[model samples]
Target chain A: MGISAVKYLLVFVVSVLLQVLFCNNILIARVIAPFIYILFIVLLPFDTPRSLLLFLSLALGLTIDVFTNTPGVHASACLIIGFLRPVILNLITSRETLESVAAPRVKTMGFHWFVTYTIFMVVIHHFFLFFIEAFTFEGFLLTLLRIVLSSVLSIALILLSQYLIFRK
Target chain B: MKNLFKLIYRYHVVFLFVLLETLSLSMVVTFNNYQRAAFFDSGNFLSGTLFEKFSSFAQIFEFKQVNIKMAEENAVLRSALQEMLLKSNHGTYHSSDSIYLPRIARDSSQKAVYRFTTARVINNSVNQQHNFITINKGRHDGIKPDMGVISNGQVVGLVTNVSENFSTVISLLNSKWKISAKIKRNDYFGSLSWDGKDYRRVQLNEMPYHVPVQNGDTVVTTGYSSSFPEGIIIGTISDFSIGSGSNFYKIEVMLAADFKNLVIVGLIENKQLNEIKHLESLNKYGN
Candidate 1:
C-alpha cells in the first residue's frame, strides 16, 4: 500500500474508535450526540477510486453498527453518503481546483468551501441515520429536531478536528 | 460480448452502490427475525467484550446517577411493602384479588402458575418512538419471548427477543405496545396504548362513556393474556374527556414505572401459557 493509503487507514481507525468509545456515550441533553466518524469519508483523497470509497464507507458504518447494536441503520446511511460524495464535490469545487486539490482540508479548500461541504454531508448522513432508525413518520418533528441538532454538533466537531489535527 | 463488458465496467460503481444499500436495508428489515436465533448482536462475544470494557470505564462517572435511581426504587419498594402489610393487618387482603396468591390452592395435581426471574437493564432508550431495552438475562437464564417484564410491581414491558445471554424488551413507551387495562373501582376494561408523544403519559381508549371514570383512578392489567398476570399496576388516570360524536371516553394515564431510570426488573414466565393457548386454540374450530 502507498503511504497515503496507510494514513487514510489510520484516520479511519481513530475516527471509529473516538465515535464508538466516547461520542456514543455522551448524550447531550439526553438527546443529541455528535457522530464524527464521517470525517474519515469526508477527508479521503479527492481522487480516491469510487469502488474503494464505497467499500471503506461500508466497513466504517458496520464497525459502528456492531458497537451501537443497530445492525443496518448506520451502514445504509454511510452508503448513501459515499455514493453522493463525488456529486457533492463537483458541485462545491471548481474544475481548476478539483484537478489540483489532493485532499479535503481547511487548508487545501478554503474555510467557506470546507464548512459548506461538511455541513451538507453531515446533514444528509444524519437525516438518513435518524429516519432509518425510527423507520416511521410517527414522530416527524422530534426526528427532525434530532437530525438538526446532531448535524450541527457533528459538523462543528469535524471542523475543529480538521483544523487542529490536520494543521499543515 | 466486448461491448457488453465495456458497458458493465462503465456502470460498475452504480451497481455496487445499489448492491450494498440493498444488503444493508435487508439486514435492518430482518433484524428482529434473526436476532434471537443468531449471536450477531451486541450481546455476542467480540462486541459484548468491547462494550463491557467501555461500560466499566464509563460506569465510574455514572455512579452518582445510579445511586439516586437505586434510592428511589428502594422508596417505591418500601411503600409497596407497607401497603401490603396494612392490607393484611386490616383483614382486607383475602377479600381483594391478590396476585401473589392463586385462586386455586396448592394441590399436587396442579402445576405451577408463574415464575419470576430478576435481570439487570444494561442498556435502555426512551427517546425513540419504538423503544427497546436490553437486559443482561436471556435464554440461559430462563427468559423467553412473550414474557412480561415488571419493575417494583409496575409494568415495564414485554420481552420480544432473546439470545443466549441477553434479551430485548419492548418498552411500554413504544407505539407498538398495547395492554389490556381496567379501572380498579369498577372493572371497566379498556385498551391501553402509547401515543408516541410523551414518555410519562399513555392513552386508554374504548371505555364506555357512562362509566364514572375519575382522575387518579388506578389502572391495572386484566391478565386476559398469558403475557402478564392480572392486577399488575399499570398506571393511574391523569386526565379524561369524552370525544365529540363518540360514545367512548378518551383517558390519559401517568405510567407507574419511570422508564428513563430503569435498572433492575423482573421477568415473569407464565408456566401455564402454553396450556392456556392450547386450550384456546382448540375452541377456534368450534369443537
Candidate 2:
C-alpha cells in the first residue's frame, strides 16, 4: 500500500508540473499543444478501485485547471481520458497478458501496442477538448483544424516523453 | 447480481469521466447570461501570479523596444499636451470608452472584455482563411475571448481561445474578422476586411462613393467604437475607387505597423464596453 501510494503521488505532481511548464508551452504549428499529463491517469494501477481512479482523475484535472485558468476544460478532458484508459488498456492487452512482468512501458507492451494505446486515448481526449473549446458549430472549421493539428503534435510528444521516462 | 456489480465496477472509470467532462463543457455553453463561473477565470489569484512571472521575462526582452516606443509616444503626448495646454481642452478628445492607463499591461484584468494583450509570435498562419497566431500568453496571462488584439498600432484581431500559459490570437488577416474604423480626415468609414490572398493588404468597404476622397488621406477611428480610441493610428489611405455598379467606395489602406515584424504589443481595454453592450441589448429586447 505504501509503495503504491508513493508511486501514484509522484506521478501526479510530476505530470501536473510537466504539463504546465513544458508540454503546454511547446506549440507546434501554433495550434498543436500536448496534454502529456493525461499519461499519469493512464498509468494508474490496474487494481486501483474504479471509484478511486475516477476521483483521482478529477482531482488531477482540476489542479491543472486551476493552474491553466481554463475553468473546467482540462478537468473534464482528464476525467474522460482517465476513465476510458482502462477500457482501452483492457482492449489493447489480450488474454495471457496478466503474466507480463514489465508495466505499461514499451518493454512490457511492444512499441506498436504502446503507440496504439497512447494514440487512441490522446485522440479522444483532444477531440473532446478542441470541441469544448470551440463550444459552437459556427467555429466548426477552426475547431476541426485545431483537433487535427493538436492531435499530431500531442501524439509525437507523448511518444517521445514516454521513451525518455520509461526507456526500453 | 454479482455480474451486475462486476459490470458497474469494471466500467466505473468511464462513467465518472463522462460525468466530469459534461460538467466542464456545460459551464462553457451556459456562459450566455449568467457568468457565475467568471470568478474562476484564468485571471484569478494563483494562476495570475504564475503567468506574471513569465510576463516579467517578456517585459525584459521588450525593454529596449519599449523605451524607443515610449520616447516616440512621449513626443506624441507632448504635442497633444501642447494643443490642450493652449486651448484649455482636456476632456473633449478622449472617447468615452477610452480609459487612460498608467501602463498598458494593467488594462488586462477581469473588467476587460475587448482588452488587447501582447505575445511573441512563435508561429502564425496567414494563408488559411481562418489564420491564427500562437502567442506566449495563455490562461495565466488573463487572455480571453472577444478581446480585440493589435500589433504595433494596427488592429490584429481578437483572442479567440486560451490555454494555461499561452494563447492563440485570431489575426486580422483572417477572413472571419472585420474590424471597425473610420477615415481620419472625414467621418466616412467602413469595415476593414482581409481578402485572404495577401497578408500585407486588407480592403475597406462601405465608404459612400459620394464622399470626397483623396489618395493620401488619414483614416482614424470613428470614436463610435468601444474597442479603440479616437486616434489610435490604424492606417493611411493607399488607394480608392468607385465600383462600376455600387454606391460605396472600394479602398485599400496601407497599415502603419509592419504586420510581419510584430513582437511586443499593447492590448486596449474599453472601460465602458460592458455597460454600452448592456444598453444596446436592452434596446433590442424592448423593440
Model 2, residue pairs in steric clash: B116-B267, B137-B166, B138-B166, B156-B172, B184-B219, B184-B220
Which stretches of candidate 2 lie above 4 Å from their native place?
Answer: A2-7, A67-69, A95-103, A137-145, A163-168, B1-15, B32-36, B57-221, B225-227, B233-287
How high is the lDDT of residue A131 in model 2? 62
Return the top candidate by DockQ: 1
Each prediction's DockQ? Answer: 0.50, 0.28
lDDT tens digits, residues A1-168, model 1? 588878888898888878866676555664586888999999998898899889989999888776565677789999999999999999988888988988888887889999999998999999999889888887799889888988898999888897677564
lDDT of 1 by residue, B70-151 (tens): 7887797667657756655432233222233343321244434667778877766665555667777778988888999999
* Deviation from native of the Cα of residue B275 in model 2, angstroms: 8.7
Error of 1 at A17 (Å): 4.9
Off by over 4 Å in 1: A2-35, A66-69, A95-100, A137-142, A161-168, B31-40, B64-75, B78-112, B240-250, B281-287
Which candidate number has the best lDDT? 1
